[model samples]
Target: MALQVQIGKTELKVNPIGLGTNAVGGHNLFPILDEQAGRQLVQTGLANGINFLDTAFIYGPKHSEEIIGEVVKENGNRSDVVIATKAAHKMVGNEIVMDNSPAFLKESADEALQRLQTDYIDLFYIHFPDKDTPKYEAVGALQRLKEEGKIRAIGVSNFSIEQLREANIDGYVDVIQGEYNLLNRDAEIELFPYVMEHQISFIPYFPLASGVLTGKYDKNTNLAEKRGKFFQKELFEKNLEKVERIRKIANEKDIDIAHVVLAWYLTRDAIDVVIPGAKRADQVLNNLKTLDVQLTVDEIQEIDQIF
Candidate 1:
């Protein structure tokens, strides 16, 4: 059965797995092996009943969003799927600076609309807050987008509790996106509590911890990348070691590691829509299949122990 979850005031039935387009043409950190493969991945995902797809404006230097727009346009009937994309981060000089100002948000929305070939997005997120931009500036910008009918809903990704509190002070934000996985639960401390009390959505990115909880990486293996190489260190190593215990529980339960971690998230009180990026068609299938796996309270507890 497909799982349907709500995001704030927006009511839409969605499969728990959202096809994330971070690597559509390629992210700034990762290079795309093939853009065609990325488009095919979206088609296959839609065919498999995935109605939610996440992408961003600055990916592939913005080539990825263009490709997504082309593919979704070619596929047609764009109404069948809910398109979720983010803004606020752009390349300025050699650094990736944040631009969450209302004016920038409006400009980015128009550009994203043209790229996605749609007038209104189902859910639009402010990619992340940066020291350069004020929270009210970002949140106020999103409020304007909502009023102008450019974006149907607004959310923020990668917010600390203090940051989230600042955004919600105006009650303009509809969702709060963060990196919450079996390993990372700091959001549970204050962020989740705020969301639960106010009825805001929690969209967890890196729900799989960059594939560490997927059981694909081990102590013997090392992660490297052009920009992703920055995450390699002792803390990451300890996190991977903790994943081994979750892997064992997944094995004993006869479920894939991704399923256990995803299903475990569903048991939480927060209204979550976890988007795990899949570079290939089969990975998309595997992630969507987690909808069928139900985690027991004990199983949820067992996995939570390591993180």
Candidate 2:
């Protein structure tokens, strides 16, 4: 049976395994994008029982949501799946700028609704915070949208602890999406505690640390130019060392290292779901395999020590 988890205080329940759809319609993000493969990816997830999907407007500037909308139509009703999307960036000529003003958020919500072909988004998030806008005021706009039946739940992504505290002052925020993984436990410092106290769900993006936790790369592996910070020699070497420890554990348990890493995340507090990106149907199936892997307290401790 698939594991069902609730999103914070919201009534929405979904399979713990969710798909991150950036690679699906994100033509600008990846090389040689395929429309058919992207549609098949979502179809495969729905066919296999994965109902939670995380996407953003900045992903291909608008393409991922479009593909998701098409897949939802072909699959069934809008309620059949939980759609989470973010909007905080707008293309200004050739530059993408972050805007968190009330007017822009409202406009973004309307655009997202039209693009997703849904009456109300399951969860709507502010993808990134702009310097000028007051965080709480931006969240207030989403709160109003929720009252007007435009969105079911509110989310804030890529926010600092201080920003999140301000945004959730009224406990209006339902979920938080952040960069977290075995390699990055910085959230444990303050963000995790606050979210847990307020009953907010923490949905981790880059849960695999840009595929490093999958144990596919070693010291000699040359990361692609697009890897950015992941391309740093010191960081890559450290990640390789940590992954080696995980690989040993996976070998001992007779499971894939990726499965062990993802399963271990469920053992932490306040993490309701994890959205690992998948460009192929087989990757979605492979991610779902995490459901079968189990980790003990000792193993969790060991994995933590490795990092």
Candidate 3:
């Protein structure tokens, strides 16, 4: 069995490396996706000992959870997997808006339960903080759900430090998900200490910085067009230099650079899970390679300095 770690103070124990299901049925996010391939990706992950499956209501707007539900039901492994999903996006007459109100949060959890085809969610997050709802009040709703046995744990995503503070005011929050990776270390400065103090597990999304930390891109590659605005010319070139340094360590260890990167995150404080999304079965298998990588303290510091 893959080694298990606790998610915050919750009773849920999951493999440190989880499958991020945004690409599973996120046809709306990525053009020209194959639903069959997406199912294969989940099957491959579960077969290989990955127990944590992270999804959200906004991904495919609902399809990701539906697909995951079908796969879990077909495999009859619902009890074996620790499924984590998020909400907060509500349809508003052909437009989507963030809603953290208590009623909406309660309604969203019930709807997500249907989409996931499960009696209870392992971890459910408030995907984003709406402008109106008090953060604590929103989390209070999820706390109620937990108490009623509708969900197992409560989480908050994309929340600022202050918002996280308010959400966890009652100490009901179990995990916090946000953008974090080797290239982006802001969480280390702003979020880690707080979560560490509160005993909340931190699950980093985009753990590979959307593949930039994978050490596959070259200086000439146009990442801006491919990845997004964050990879503009100057910043991309600087990050490439850092990736090269990590590539040397990866080569020395005889492992894939992406594996080295993921391994490094596991060593950091308060980071309990790293959910890297994959579109192919092979890619899903590749992510599992991260578990075998054991970095020395000096190497960890070297990687820390490189980024």
Candidate 4:
């Protein structure tokens, strides 16, 4: 079994490598998806020692959480898994908007608990910041939920540094999830320092950069319309070059480049968990291989310089 690590100041402990379920049942996020494959992915992860499962309400507008709930219920191991889910999206007629009000967040939590078919959520994150709500106030709602035993931990995702500061003002925030990877180091500039000083765990999304950092693409590979601006010709070509350098290290170490990349993030400060999404059960198992990748200081630094 992979050793579990604490989620920020919370008692909830999870495998360092978690399964991101956006690709599992997120039909809206992805053009096409197999519901059976999504169920199998969650089942494979749980049976194979992966106890942390990350999902959000916006993913398929609720499908991901539903699928995860069904799997956990069927597996009969809800006690063994650490489930982290987020909410902020609310429907107003036909349009969706972000909401952080106490009532909305509390309602979202109750809805999530029902969808997850669990009595209590291990971790509940305010998925995104709304322009109208005070950041601290939004997190305060989660604090109240914690007090009520509805949730064990509070988290905020996609908040700016200032927003994070405001949200953590009461010291109720336990974790922060944001876009971070070797390719995108913006969080390292300020977010990393704050989280480390505050003893907050940082869960990095897109740890694989949508598969760009997996070392599967080359100059000849066509990714023009794939990842929008990130895959624009010039930058994509440049990133491919850096990935080749990572490939060299992976080859020398007899490991997959994706594993090397995931392992590298594990060594970073304030980064306690990496949720790499998988579309199939085999891919979920493959992500677990990252646990065995041990990189030396020299190798870590070399990869850092290459990025």
TM-score of each: 0.90, 0.97, 0.98, 0.98
- What is the number of backbone collisions in each predicted candidate, taken in the order shown? 0, 0, 0, 0
Winner on TM-score (1 vs 3): 3
**Candidate 1: tens digits of C-alpha lDDT, residues 1-307:** 4556676666655776787778788756474466677888888888888888888877776777788788778877787778888888776788878877777878888888998888888788888787866787788887877888878787888888888888778888788888777666778888888898888978887887777778777666645541242247776688777777777777876878878888788778885677888788888888887887767778777767767
Ranking according to TM-score, highest score first: 4, 3, 2, 1
Q: List the residue pairs that clash in candidate 4.
A: none
Better-scoring candidate (lDDT), 2 or 4: 4
Write one digit per residue (lDDT tens) for candidate 2, span 50-138: 99988889888799998898899889767879999999997899998899999999999999999999889999999998999989899
lDDT of each residue in 208-255, candidate 3, tens digit only: 876788988898786647867447788888988988898888999899
Q: Candidate 4 on 1-307: residue-level lDDT in tens?
A: 6789887789988899899999878999988899899999899999999999999999998999999999999998688999999999999999999999999999999999999999999999999899999999999999999999999999999999999999999898999999998889999999999999999999999888878899877777777557655688898999988998899989988989999999999999798889999999999999999999999999999999998
Candidate 3: residue 4 lDDT (0-100): 93
The candidate with the higher lDDT, 1 or 2, is 2
Top model by lDDT, which number?
4
How many angstroms is residue 150 displaced in model 3 relative to the true structure, after the best TM-score fit?
0.5
Look at candidate 3 and tell me the lDDT of residue 288: 93
Q: Model 4 off-target regions past 4 Å?
A: none
RMSD of each: 2.5, 1.3, 1.0, 0.9
- Assess each prediction's global lDDT (C-alpha) against the native: 0.78, 0.89, 0.91, 0.92
